[model samples]
Target: MTGEELGRDEENTAVAGPVDADGSAEIGELIGRLSGDDDLDRETRGRLLGRLARLLGQSARKAGAAGVARGKWLTDLLVAAAPHIPIRDLETLRAHHHGLIGEELADSVVRVASNGTTAVGAAGGALAAVEFVAPPLLLTAPAQLAAETLVIAAIEVKMIAELHAVYQVRVDGTGTARGAAFLTSWARQRGVNPLESGSLTSALGSAAKSALRKRLLKTLGRSMSTMGPFLTGAAAGAALNRAATKKLAEHVRKDLRGGADPIKPLPGGYPSVGPADKP
Candidate 1:
């Protein structure tokens, strides 16, 4: 074939290539270098990490608020279904991280079940719950918001944990795990229980690590599109949150079936576990 004809054929082939999972063309090598590079200047790396953290925090908070709203709805649904859901204690809830973690976790789970990757399933379940209850937000704004925030925080915790795993960050019981512990303690001070508060940290950390690796592989599979580091990070966070939330909802569903109580009592006040508990 003539050189020009060969060139045209190649160009056309490129144009016809399949799109990446995130809708962007592949920029695998670049993304790998950026994500994997540890030798980059500290300032640059710090900035990138900070930016991602901020985005995640903001997304988490928004998601948390949404979760609180959903939680209120779910609580009402539970009550309607059994008329004896056992009123969740505000004092107990407060002990669980200022209500932030609880709100985020609830929100995250609802989002996963409602408008997330498994939206169909979530929506079905949510609708069923709604049919039974009058809807929480319309009834109690603060409680609803708190529940949503708890769910979102749970997803974020999982996401961060997952990222730490992918990066091979030593969990020597230090770093993120420690941070999570501290956060848990902080929540307890406000009256939230460890079961709920600790769950958020664990969920977020696990989700982040798992999602980061999955997203990395997904980014690698495409051919033409390139995802900037920032975008990739965000996408990874979002995906991880969605997955974690779904898992959490499944757990919740199981608990509900088992007649689990909404809030559990913590062993002690704040920081239930200590440094020695680190593994």
Candidate 2:
């Protein structure tokens, strides 16, 4: 084949190749890095953390303007983005975490996820505070907070999915199907239903939608406190995010645990457990 033709064919193959391969690998790498021991120096960690926070802020801005999470906007936004979220399956997760299993695996997931959400909040808050100094930036605070809120939601949703995997709560479907299920769980701030039909239709009932909207508004309002001037806003933002993430992890863990006995670690740090409801 001619050079140009060969190059064109290669480009087409690249474009048609499995997109999730790269995306899934990236998500796995991100989770692995975050869940690993804190080895980076303080300055390096701070820089990385800040960059993540800024990225979350950017994501939040794309979801909505004026920080209003009402009606169908939040729901629609999530549904549209659900297919793009990179969700690793159980085997993939096990590989990423060095075969850690049961409660230890679960703990690492929650810790890293919480750190991410808190970083988003602190970064968004700091940016918002800076706006107070520059009047023009004042107009941007709501958007920044909005971005932070969405980004935090995404992180928590991914955590919920991985936690389900940790507990061996098998969710059946394509990656997008599983993502929608967990995305719904994230919106409701609740645990996934193992018996759920794995269909998007049944997930977004009127009542659930209403509750989701209310919850989003409440979260956004709390984020507003992070808009205070300077250091005050930054401190409040970080604390709020940290506490919120911790609370979310607790609630999700409780639901996932489902009154079952604590997961006992097996040989090689993997847990030999299944969902409590499973026979």
Candidate 3:
């Protein structure tokens, strides 16, 4: 090969090397950005999903129809990425909600998270695990909507963590400790009770792993709607996510209290989702 041609090849290799070498970190960053934002516009959201799709494409063109705990891969990634998920503090929550506090603050947090999840679903984002299941054509969907599942989980985890802060439900530990505790709470679909065994671990226990896998599968089920025609997918995915988020928030808010009263969906069920979370 001529020197110029070889030099161009070298330049291209240099550019692509980082992505190939550090895909996991990159994916974690993407998850953080997508989940942390309450106002990710559609174009930006689509671009980010495209990046995620390309990265997942590198691992393998096909995904294994792995047996029970088919969510194992997703769970593993989430545990590793938990520490990196962006969780706002109580001050941020109060600021974001216009000084709302107590049950009012709690209510707004749930609404924001529910709306964020809805934005992810309606963004016309990644085709998700479709690359793993069906023909490799059109948008790249994670195998069984793996991408959406992870992003949605991150949003929920962040919200749950923030909720603890809102209620002054102090989970004593380092950041990683708190992240892990909150992650476990997300997997269990409950709140982290500070008084109970500390609830802090850097890794998932086998039981927690099981619960996470189950949780992931449940989220994945909702994502299946995205496989339908475009509008149908977006609408169904949004509605399902909004409803699920509100339900999970109910469980968590109750879990966070002393003699916590049982919580249920708003009398008529969740309010309709907006184009994005307000502000």
Candidate 4:
């Protein structure tokens, strides 16, 4: 090559090396900006940390539940068939309910159940596993489950209200009357029964709310650094319940071929009788 061409090529090579180094440095800086630092402002750090924590908790819960569901398919199968393999007492139920809902709401339900001398109950011990899992996400299985249950409950109430519309039942009192009216109307439109819907709503609502409170109290008992355990446990439990429920519903739908679909709405708002209702 000519001298001038060779010189130009050498200069070009020298310029390219620094440009490559500069590009690498810029990429490193961008990564640093994305990650931020411990010394970042409290609000910014907290928000980032919280988001990371929640993401981790959700992932963990989903994984854990899937593992548990595979191992205990038989137990889940039994629970789906009978809907009452593991019976829980009032206090135990209270705790589960708290986890599903929140403290105050669960407490209210407990008080109401106690006053009427009516015992509230739930099906399957899968939720117990959930209580054991979620803690990292600042939630319990019951708390997460409560949201699902509320969706179920609202559907039940709507069904009952619709039923009342069909029967021409004028329910105009307080408490039970109101509940009955709502439930009746809810069931009719939903093509279910008020009593059945009411039962599921009561059971799920009670369990989720109780579980939530227990988690909060446990978190409060620990120091800030140790709070991760509570949040992790809660997230784990919620994830476990979701997976277990899905598995159980699938098994039920496959094995139990009745008019009742465990994953779908029952004739009323009862615990999803078919696969369609599985969370």
Count residue pairs with overlapping backbones in model 2: 1
- Residue-wise lDDT of candidate 4 within 50-155, one digit each (tens)? 3333333443355465642332321111111111111122343435445433334333333332221110001112222334455452364332222222222222
On a 0 to 100 scale, what is the lDDT of residue 207 in model 3?
64
By summed lDDT, the worst window of 10 consecutive residues in model 3 runs over 1-10
Cα-lDDT of candidate 4: 0.27
TM-score of 1: 0.22
Tens digit of lDDT per residue, candidate 2, span 14-98? Answer: 1112323323323223323332334545345444444444444454455455443453544444443343344565676666678
| Alpha-carbon runs more than 4 Å astray in model 1 | 1-137, 174-177, 181-279
- Single out the weakest 10-residue window by summed lDDT for candidate 4: 1-10
**Once superposed on the true structure, which residue ranges of model 4 sit more than 4 Å away at CA?**
1-135, 138-140, 174-176, 180-279
Task: Put down candidate 3 lDDT per residue, 173-262, tens digits, no spaces.
Answer: 434445555666787777765544422233345666677778888887887876666466777888889999999888888888755532
TM-score quality measure for candidate 4: 0.20
Compared with the true structure, the alpha-carbon lDDT of candidate 2 equals 0.55
TM-score quality measure for candidate 3: 0.77
Ranking by lDDT: 3, 2, 1, 4
**Clashing residue pairs for model 3:** 127-141, 128-141, 128-142, 129-141, 129-142, 129-143
Using TM-score, give the best candidate's number. Answer: 3
* lDDT per residue (tens digit) for residues 1-279 in model 1: 100100012222121123334312222111122222124553443333333323333433544656423333222211111111111222332343244334353443244233322221122223223323454423332222222222233223332222222222222222223333322322221211223433212212333223322332232221001111323433443454356445544444333333344323233321222223222
Model 3: lDDT to the true structure: 0.64
Once fitted onto the true fold, the runs of candidate 2 whose alpha carbons sit more than 4 angstroms away are 1-71, 174-176, 196-203, 260-279
